[model samples]
Target: MPPPPPTHADPPVLVIRPDSARTLGLAGDLWAFRDLLWSLADRDLRLRYRQTALGVAWVLLQPVLGALIFTFVFGVVAGLPSDGVPYFLFTFASLAGWALFAGILTRASGSLVQNSPLIAKVWFPRAVLPASTLPAALIDFLIALLLLGGMMAWAEVAPGIAILTVPLWVLALAMLALGLGLIGSALMVSYRDVQHILPVGVQLLLYASPVAYSASNVPERFLALYYLNPLAPLLEGLRASLLGTPMPPTNTIVWGATVALGTFVLGAAVFRRLERRFADVI
Candidate 1:
């Protein structure tokens, strides 16, 4: 007798569709894959210090060392004002926030390309990649914050009631970072130039913001335009809250919040528009 006819069953089908044609339940999908988000975040945390002798100390060292350098160069040599707080504290406070924002932006911009193999083989919310970078940045931020607390205690300088608003300012910075990261990551799938441009942009932003000096130092004529950098007011507000310096005006904080929200929405829209082509191009 001849061999029996081979059994055949239809293979499972995953009908991939363009983002425009598909209604993506982004929130739901992200919620469902919450485990993956943390997993990727954990992976990032591990990989960050995997083989380093200093381990997590690098996080503390960076802002601390930078603060010292800036204190000497800008504060001592240049006689820059520090908003009434010690220059070291002033620079450290701003550096902590800057590190968080820069870490998220840098890690997220490269996330998609770094995980190109996984992306090509799997199907999950691509947003998760950029989102995952945030946890690591937050962890670094918290570590840096602890060091700042110690420094403040040693200096006998206590945070005021405004310190309670620290988390809110952190949230605002995260929003801006994640938004820009999304835009950069999406664009990176097509343009490698973004990778080169981002570091330069970040460096420029470092000088542009009130990191090494006081926002108050900006000339009266240019102060308004300086605060236009969104990160400016947020950083100033955060430093004020931490170091008990003067708070930014209510209007400025409101403006910063609005700009952060707008940037986040714009980033999501840009990412969605380009996400469909990511797998094909990346």
Candidate 2:
């Protein structure tokens, strides 16, 4: 047999630059760095449960604890309607949906600051910091959903064919939360003040939302403004699909989705504009 010619490697390419390019190419940037995003997400998920005794159980515990507290406060103490479902299941279902949104927003909002050392030492899409939070939050959400499925079975609630549509609702909520998170992260990089107020704002928004209570509780006069919250229709639709609660009007979901998309564009703009100075300030 004759020996084959040796293969040669291609030369590496390198360059230096002074002024940075300004363009709205975040999607392309994120696509290019998809591996980095998955690595960061996997690292976060590991670190999250590394030393914990309960590990992934904490994901189930948090919403369970919250649901218990809410059931006591709203179901027993304050008297809230659950639309014929047990209060715990009702609140848990609602809370489960909200948790996904809240978790993503919280993580993404702080991603830049949390990864400050990496941002300083390395070069990647700054957008990836916020982008990576989605997968981790999604993992948490899926675990929580398993618990929710059990709760639904306990409550004798059955999800119908409509269950197929749940992802669309979740997508709308994710888009909205991510949009806010990106904007908050950009602002957080410049002004640490956002960190101080972001949790409080999230808490306020949680309570202001229909988590423990029913969306029907909102008066007709304020209904218009309530649906304007973007989360309103998404949460309502989620509850409807999962727990069989009354669905929000189709218009509400459509409007909220449109608003979410617009908000995402605005957030991306703000993120890109402020991204250049991240290493300097962060």
Candidate 3:
């Protein structure tokens, strides 16, 4: 027995290693874990409907309710113009885009904290948490769009060639929401105040955005600063797409996309940098 013990292999190298240096290759990592992303997203969609009687109908309901209120206030009382489009149709179109962007940002910002347990135990890429909300929000957007189509048909307003730009406009909105969401989610782990403030912040943003009114309402002098709000071009573009109103100038849309991309990049970098601390802090 003693002689057999002496023939053992090299002490099973107990290499004490520090955490492997993880570079946040967001695109590469995200592509690699596409299945995880889909799973998380499906979970979110399911949770969104869990225990709810109306289920996904809530998606169609939200924008419609908001549109009714805004139409009464802005159209009936304030007498805002809808650029020859019916006020109901005009407001509904704008609501579809605004709701999607705002909903994505709101849900995404809270995604990390909401899934704290998963974050603590999982070795998956953290970005997937926030990105998962996008698809659910996009589903809500499409459902709302169906309602918008009904409104359009009722009003007999046919979307022209300008409608082709809707995809580009939606891409810009998604980028903007992702950037804001990433920043919010990162900040939220360390500072819980963000959770309380996000709803109020989004509420204020709704009025500031051209969801109820038109960008044309802004005086020429303020147009420069007005366009600075990324939602400005997106909401306007949506309205134009549905109602054939004037599109945000190409330059403005380009500038908005640039800002959106910049925000997303900055947010991703900050999120990755802060993510190492999340498990400990959250």
Candidate 4:
């Protein structure tokens, strides 16, 4: 018998074409490969701690060290307000949450370039590269939260009904980080400048955000502009709810949430729109 012709019934067809289509359909595309999210996240986590002595202990130590520095500079020396909680407790709690966002953003921003070999060889959603960073970052967030809980207990800060909504505020921050990450990751594929600027930008954002300080620190004249950062109201509300301080006005919180949602949608669209060129550029 002569050579048999190769045949595959309903073979998967991935048509790589230049995209002008700006659609929110990236969700469906990414959802199809959800398993890869976990796999990639696990692989990344293992690689991160591969040869490290402390391994996961770094998670607890990282925020603790940062908090100690902030406690001395902002809490002890500067005598910043902690909304009635111990300044160490206040700064540490906020730093825990802020770390989640910053960590995710940093991972996601460089995901494409770091995984360029896989991007070129494998057929998968590029978005997975960034989305996978979330799990590892979230794991760190949970560990850090345990530290925060201990701090809260030490301070005798009993949370109220507002604490129940902490997840909502977290989701809001995650959405914003993902949105920013997608934009940065996509841009980095073609423009290397984004990679260079991202670190400085994130550092500036940390100060702009209410991580080490309270929202009330901003002068009245700048309150409106400050809340425009979206994280301002969310962080303030979170700190208040967790530490039993007063939450920001309900209107500001609602507006911040709305902005968060919009950012997510915008980021997704931008990522998908530019996703087609990733293989060529990366």
Q: What is the TM-score of each candidate against the true structure?
A: 0.91, 0.91, 0.90, 0.91
* Model 3 lDDT tens row, 114-139: 99999899767788899989899898
Top candidate on TM-score is 1
Q: Could you tell me the TM-score of candidate 2?
A: 0.91
Q: After superposition, how far is residue 126 of candidate 4 from its true place, in Å?
A: 1.0
Most lDDT-accurate candidate = 1
Q: Which scores greater on lDDT, model 1 or model 2? A: 1
C-alpha RMSD between model 1 and the true structure: 5.6
lDDT, candidates in the order shown: 0.87, 0.85, 0.85, 0.84
lDDT of 1 at 248: 82
Ranking 3 against 4 by TM-score, winner? 4
Clash pairs for candidate 3:
none
Off by over 4 Å in 3: 1-24
- Number of backbone collisions per candidate, in order? 0, 0, 0, 0
Give the C-alpha miss distance for residue 200 in model 1, angstroms.
Answer: 0.6
Model 3 RMSD in Å is: 6.5
Model 1 agreement with the true structure over 102-125: per-residue lDDT tens digits? 988899899999999988889777
**Residue 244 accuracy (lDDT) in model 2:** 76
* Poorly placed runs, candidate 1 (over 4 Å): 1-24
